[model samples]
Target chain A: MHSLTRSFLAVALLASVSAAHAHRTWLLPSAAQVDGKDPWVTVDAAVSEDLFELGANALKLDGLSITDPDGGSVQPNQTSTGKYRSSLDLKLAKSGTYRISLVSETAMASYKLNGEMKRWRGNVADLKKEVPAEAEELSVSTTLGRLETFVTAGKPNGTALKPVGSGLELIPLDHPSEFLAGQPARFRLLLDGKPLPGLTVAVVPGGVKYRGVLKETALTTDAKGEFTVNWPTPQMYWINAGYPARVNVPEGQPRPPMPAKRYNYSGTFEVLPQ
Target chain B: MQKRKLLLTAVLASALPALAAELSVKIDIPQLAVAEYHRPYIAMWLEKADGGQVTQLAVWYDQKKKDNGGTKWLKDMRQWWRKGGRDLEVPLDAVTSATRAPGLHALNFAAGKAPLGQLAAGEYTLFVEASREAGGREVVRVPLSWPPKEARSTGSKGQEELGNVTVQLKP
Candidate 1:
């Protein structure tokens, strides 16, 4: 009976790991481009098993940041969280691009404690305080993720598109707001302020509930870490890229040991009709 | 001294071309038999051979709307908006005007002027885009060389939203 319970616990753990991979986190905006003065844009943040259909959980807003066109920070006018999604309304008084992003670093661990399997998710500092030192088969991983969307009030500018030089980021070679169907949009990928080349990026258009096929487009970056996407139709698109690396821990560190680090970047872009 | 300067200016003027180059544009707003129709917002601009915007010549919108409400729909002209229209502060006395009725409107621009004085002698394309409420959008282009060695006329036609668009260059 003991061996059978152990085997079942292992299967459950494997299923949970795959479930995490199936869920995608995203931010969807009401409008990508606004022409009038002092326009307002509402954004919905969520994580779901489908591309953009809110189903899994409401994404936490603890790391939310809004960068205006002039590189100044702005606060959301209103914010709310429901069971499936978190949303915010932002007033775009500025005349250029605004970047709404949620950046977070989380440490997650799965371990066996008292003959039972358990999982813990929180910041790095809480690992020791929450998970007992006597826990067996403890495996910890850290994830640094950024999910973002862009909106232009009057004209699209590059001021807010500048990368923060940490984790994975997408640099637009062309204006993000100007993506059109049948036209190729170019972007570059950077990891920790350096080029991340030879990576496969996935582009999936939203409205999956109505379409019969997912029709996902996979693109690869070149030596310059640049990739081009020829949008098939006019709709909101979700693009994501991920990279994993083994963490190098210094000798005799007092903190809990994290074995690996994962970097994830995702963006929501709207492509207009030609 | 003033007389001498005038004499020098006259000599220089005589050395140059007798007639200043001028561009005359004729745009036709088509009358559609649709249930709901609004005067189309039009944007006319000059672009270089490589598709870079050179200058905005004209924009026709409903300037009488309350508190610049007409500017809200300017994004419907997506091509021009992406080119440079989004950056402009409308009600600009130079290039902005009220929407026109369904008819042909002729506008003349002098070469040595505020908007056109910066144009160099090269090949350029004129882009005219129009969008309407509850209607379709259309774009028409006319390619011509600046400071034409001789008079020339070029034009393009649209099936909807707009009619014939003509560009006449005078040397």
Candidate 2:
């Protein structure tokens, strides 16, 4: 029993370390809700674990797509890509909710048994066809990080607040446009159309340009996959949450090879000042 | 005499938009009776009725200083910094200038120029945000309709950081 506890502790430590290093993509807009008079809302997007440091070096723009309120496609142009920041701007033409989503291409990580120790090297897609299947038990994992946010113009009365389909999604319990400073905003996490509970949700006070470390208030969801954060000040915030899936070689059951999966979700909302 | 008459008509045609779309902004850098009085960084831009950026009219900071020292303080103007100011390399041609002192200053943009040229016959909100060192910050958003519809002019009074701000969009 003591040895089993020690092994469990070791596994827990490894999971915590990996979670700390996981990168997330964040999409932030200038305003969560705009009145009829304001013509546009500028959105800033980046892939990074730390909000201040955008991972432009490894980040690609091919996965970005925006669906406007009128069921039209709105393209966001890459405005700038500095060393620590990458930004995009969108021209909000009509009044309704705009959905900005980033769907990344799958990245593979594989480890091979070399003599006694397993060495993680090269892309699994390339190595799988070359490496001999008898020489190793391949443990490969595929990761697809997704980020999305919804902003409205005029009012959110007719806007659809339900899921528009994503691997992991955080839908605001109430209208995001109604979020005001000093109010507790609630959101529900969904994984495959069901509630996801006991996950860590982080809320960063400022947007990507915030020149500081990743200091955020971490909150946990309840049994119903709901979490709340009381915004003290009126400012831009990036809320992030993630989940992982792991599967191994089946016991006596023949099934096709499957890679483990990890899904990350991030959303940005503004707590309007009074 | 025909040549002179043609010249007069051409000049009037060119000046038509300028007379139609005019913005007279009065930014007062409050004279704080203090020792370390660094001029505040100010930015003026127009946004469409839906919150889209129209054009940046002027951004005043310490441009002449070497090594781009003045830009370091622009983050103090939070709203503009997030909008589009951070992407702009300081000392931008025709758009950047030195900081002003406490008084009323005038800025005129001709038709077929920034803002006026980009104006697409719609409603707009003029945003003026200012930030100072060791001082308070303020943002003023003014509302206006494009093409003036009928020579419409609007103005607003700042509480502390700025003075009477007026904009005229004529037809």
For model 1, the docking class works out as incorrect
Score every model by TM-score: 0.55, 0.48
Clashing pairs in 1: none
Show where candidate 1 strays beyond 4 Å.
A1-15, A114-117, A123-125, A245-259, B1-171
Task: Tell me the DockQ of each model, to 2 decimals.
Answer: 0.01, 0.01
Q: Kindly provide the TM-score obtained by chain B of candidate 2 when compared with the true chain B.
A: 0.81
RMSD of 2: 21.7
lDDT tens readout by residue for model 1, A1-274: 7555545544444344434654678999998998875699999999975567777799989899999999999999999999999999998888999999999887777778997889887877788999999999776777888999999998789999998899999988889988999999999999998888988888878875454234567688999999999999999999888774222223333322333687888899999999
Give model 2's DockQ, 2 decimals. 0.01
The native-contact fraction of candidate 1 is 0.00
* lDDT tens digits by residue: candidate 2, A224-254: 9999889877777777675753322233343
TM-score, prediction 2: 0.48
Interface RMSD of 2: 16.7
